[model samples]
Target: MALDGQNVCRHHGGNAPQSLRAGERRVTEERARVLVETYGRKIETTAAEALLDEVQWTAGHVAWLRERVQEIESEAAVAATDREHPLVWGVTREKSGGEDRGTTEEAAPNVWLKLYQQERTHLVKVCSEAIRAGIEERRIKLAEQQGVLVAQAIRAILGDLDLTVEQQARVPEVVPRHLRALAS
Candidate 1:
């Protein structure tokens, strides 16, 4: 569908009514064309940098949490073995019949299981928090980059229009009589 000044201007009907002059409208259209042509390349570079920053920030936190969980698991395994072979680890006592022997085999305690589970849960929480923080940081960076890209595009457009100021100032004189009548 085609858009016209009437439709575009309707949004600001109540406050400080304003309209784009013919030359200004041409310049604005040129600016929009330039932005469309150049914005993607600029945004792509910015987004890549933002993503890298986020990855760098999160990598260390993730590695530390993984190492901690691995340590916890190793300790839990050792504790389980100790519970099963108390004599093997020198924790057994001799029986009353003067026979040197080991104690009955017992299953690993529930406390060890609980501790392992808790440590695993904490590790997951830490990893998740790191990921969320990374994502948030990346989003912030991307938003900032997008703002810079937009501003750069505007400046570029202004610069191009500035170079054509003299030529653009002569457009109204070339306007057709029919178009001028319609404007009136």
Candidate 2:
């Protein structure tokens, strides 16, 4: 049957047809509300799951890195031990012949000091060489610049004398000996 806006449904006794325009509007509104709620819940759930996974992965990586760091530290400590001879912190003479007992810490500082001194010596030599090279390069550049300035001064003198190119080139040969010596 063709149902209008106020038409009543047969199944609901006196209730209006849910398929009518007004009824459809209410249904559409409810459907939209449901969709928004479901979509929001799914988004929140996915974000929460991703965050948890990231936290788990980061914790695992940090734990692994920590273990590796500890292992490296232990290896370094063992390698730092001096294998030359047993240290003698104090001497003990009993029924036994002789025994030396001490911590290896005393020799470590001396070894490190020698290494530092050698490194300082190397650094000084390198720095000195670098400075010397820089000074030499600067001297060379300055000499070249001075030569250019001298040449320009000579050209200006020739120009002031109103000399042509040919005259300028021959002035040295035509000048008196005393004048040439004074110019030189």
Best by TM-score: 2
Give the C-alpha miss distance for residue 40 in model 2, angstroms.
Answer: 85
Q: Please provide, for model 2 over 1-184, each residue's C-alpha lDDT reduced to its tens digit, 9 standing for 90 to 100.
A: 3333334554543244445657667667878889888875534455334444444555555555555545644655676744422221222222433354343243232333344455555555554554555644665788789867866887688779998789977866765454557668
Q: Supply the global lDDT for candidate 2.
A: 0.54
As for candidate 2, its clashing pairs are: none
Estimated TM-score per prediction? 0.21, 0.23
The lDDT for every candidate, in the order shown, is 0.54, 0.54
Candidate 1 residue lDDT tens string, 1-184 = 2134333443554122344454356668878888889873345455445555545545654566556556656765877864444322332233555455546433443443445455556556655655665766776798789867866775576567764767566544543453457557
After TM-score superposition, the amount by which residue 93's alpha carbon in candidate 1 deviates from its true location, in angstroms, is 37
In angstroms, give how far residue 156 of model 1 lies from its true place: 35
**Candidate 2 — which residues are off by over 4 angstroms?**
1-133, 164-166, 171-184
Rate residue 85 of model 2 by lDDT. 24
